[model samples]
Target: MTSKPPLLASMFAPWPRIPIDTTDGSDFFHLDRVAGSAATGWALGPEGAYEQNLTLAEVVDGAVREALLHLLELGLIDIDSDRLNAAPGLPTHRERAVP
Candidate 1:
């Protein structure tokens, strides 16, 4: 009488498929398909084979963040913390009503 592993635990079990390479020589884990599969629950690989969308979201998110940080390090993008933190004042209607 062995207890079954949790569904989430099983869902995250090691990925069984190997990544295919693109014609341009990039490794194809199909990031776009995988990301979309979070809502669809299925992804099509480069070979047109269906795959279960699992921990790939975390992988894709980390990859995107790494790419953005790399771009920032290269000075290709700017981050204005002050602008991001600045709060917009009250709505025009509220401000007029207050006065």
Candidate 2:
């Protein structure tokens, strides 16, 4: 029998090692795909400490909207149905991209 690929194989592919810098240039963080059988999601944190998977709810939180918008503008994360449905008020990545 043929074996099927892991469910999140595509979603968890190696991401570009880009750091999202804070507006004040105080610190920066990265968004990474955490692919595992037990848990999977976007990991948002600075290097060395406080790395944690972000849930859909957390991503949509008001406190995180600014960062989320920045991420979308940078093309780090693609806008999809799930995200669109989750945060209907947010603009699409294309709409928010910098000229």
Candidate 3:
């Protein structure tokens, strides 16, 4: 049987991470919004959901940088679909990449 190329959705889903609102400005990027902000120093982004940030500006910036690094080093290419598919005879994209 032949396999398929992994789709981006399966591996990740859309979720809120930082609680920052440029319009509000007052709230800024409150870490409290993040589910596990106190523990992980990260936010509950697409990779995770309700099951889950940084400062107003610094925190948000840092989070984005970190996420980008993960994608680059891990080779996590974005896909348009909602299902995460993988190439045959290869390890899962997320698993292969490391922090």
Candidate 4:
């Protein structure tokens, strides 16, 4: 048997999901698709349902980081996912593991 190359991993990547989070762990949130429309939204609930809707412009202007964080918190993305472990954001392979 032989190991496959890492570049092949990106060939079947899934589309990114929204990122968001509750400042505290007391809240639970979920994304919901809008019925009868092409748009999607999110909501929070269990005790009470509260939603913070995002505008298209807001999302395009770095607001997506919130959704990314939310997805990370939920373990929706793998620990070694390229988006989370890309270079420049991390130390070089030759660098010491600790400073």
Candidate 5:
């Protein structure tokens, strides 16, 4: 049987490394209810569901970035996806070169 491409191989890659504290909590990005803040970008607060101090401008943007980071670790994202897909798992469109 033909093997899958390396790019597509990431789909089965292991989960990204997450920093967990002794309390079994995250130590990276902090998920907070930034909706309260008037700041155009979302902000993370203490005691977040995820990490504890990662403050992002847009909550959606932050979530995506974090997810991509994890997927990249396991090679889940296809190389072509990044180059071909207008939206490479990101909020914006990342078009590849025509050639």
Candidate 6:
């Protein structure tokens, strides 16, 4: 049997050469509807939830991280559904929250 590839693990890939910035986290977790209504806004899809953009993670504020945890516990973000896909790369301001 073959092991499943590391999906989220890709973000932590080796990049020592890439400088890492050290700073405090932020508190910002903007949410939007997934393929909801065409005109009006509403949750849709497998169950019901919005798909967040990777760019939003840039503001990794302590409070935001807390909210994220809350959402995760509430099943807003599927830790198993494999949703919220994004390109492999650092987004603007993301490094600022690093370290």
1 versus 6: better TM-score goes to: 1
Model 1 per-residue lDDT at 90: 17
Candidate number with the higher TM-score (1 or 4): 1
Which ten-residue region of model 5 has the weakest summed lDDT?
27-36
Tell me the spans in candidate 5 whose CA falls farther than 4 Å from its real position. 1-57, 81-99
> If scored against the real structure, what TM-score would every candidate get?
0.32, 0.25, 0.26, 0.26, 0.28, 0.26
What is candidate 2's lDDT per residue for 1-99, written digit by digit as tens?
123222222443432232334343332323422111112222233421125344556644522455465566667655667644544253223322322
**lDDT value for model 4:** 0.36
Q: Which residue pairs collide in model 1, if any?
A: none
Off by over 4 Å in 3: 1-54, 78-99
- On TM-score, the stronger of 2 and 4 is 4
Which regions of candidate 2 are displaced past 4 Å? 1-29, 32-60, 82-99
Error of 4 at 66 (Å): 1.0
User: What lDDT does the true structure give each of the candidates?
Assistant: 0.40, 0.38, 0.38, 0.36, 0.37, 0.35
- Winning candidate number (lDDT): 1
Over all chains combined, what TM-score does candidate 1 have?
Answer: 0.32
Off by over 4 Å in 4: 1-61, 81-99
Clashing pairs in 2: none
Q: After superposition, how far is residue 21 of candidate 5 from its true place, in Å?
A: 36
